[model samples]
Target: MAKWGEGDPRWIVEERADATNVNNWHWTERDATNWSSEKLKELLMGLWVEGEEGKCEITEVSKVE
Candidate 1:
């Protein structure tokens, strides 16, 4: 499985005019300001757990653009 926050390798930071490959799709990280609380919770749960006592806690969320 891919690591969280590292993003997908198929994602590009810039757009290509002659882009014709599915592996070269432009994907940028947009601001999460408009995300709902439920949406955030779902994402947090997707995190990898190490042990039985592993717990995920989200204390703060920052605005990204």
Candidate 2:
């Protein structure tokens, strides 16, 4: 949901991390350069979707992350 891929949507869903903590991740191009395609994409997804307040949080808890 972070809308990782730049040009299009891939429907690749992933888990969500702690909303208030970006402690371990280094969300930058350098860090992503070494990642596998899937891994890099996941990171990208993590970038924008992590903070969405209502879009993903409802009725049931998000199973992501």
Best by TM-score: 1
On lDDT, the candidate that comes out on top is: 1
Candidate 1: regions farther than 4 A off: 1-35, 49-65
Q: Worst ten-residue run, lDDT, model 2?
A: 56-65
Residue 57, candidate 2: how far off, in angstroms? 18
TM-scores of all candidate predictions against the true structure: 0.21, 0.19
What tens-digit string does per-residue lDDT give for candidate 1 at 1-65? 55666778785544458665555354655666657655776676556546688866655555434
Clashing pairs in 1: none
| Stretches of model 2 off by over 4 angstroms after superposition | 1-35, 49-65
lDDT of 2 by residue, 1-65 (tens): 24445533564333467543244454423444434665655555534334545444223323334
At residue 18, candidate 1 shows an lDDT of: 65
Instruction: Supply candidate 1's per-residue lDDT for 22.
Output: 51
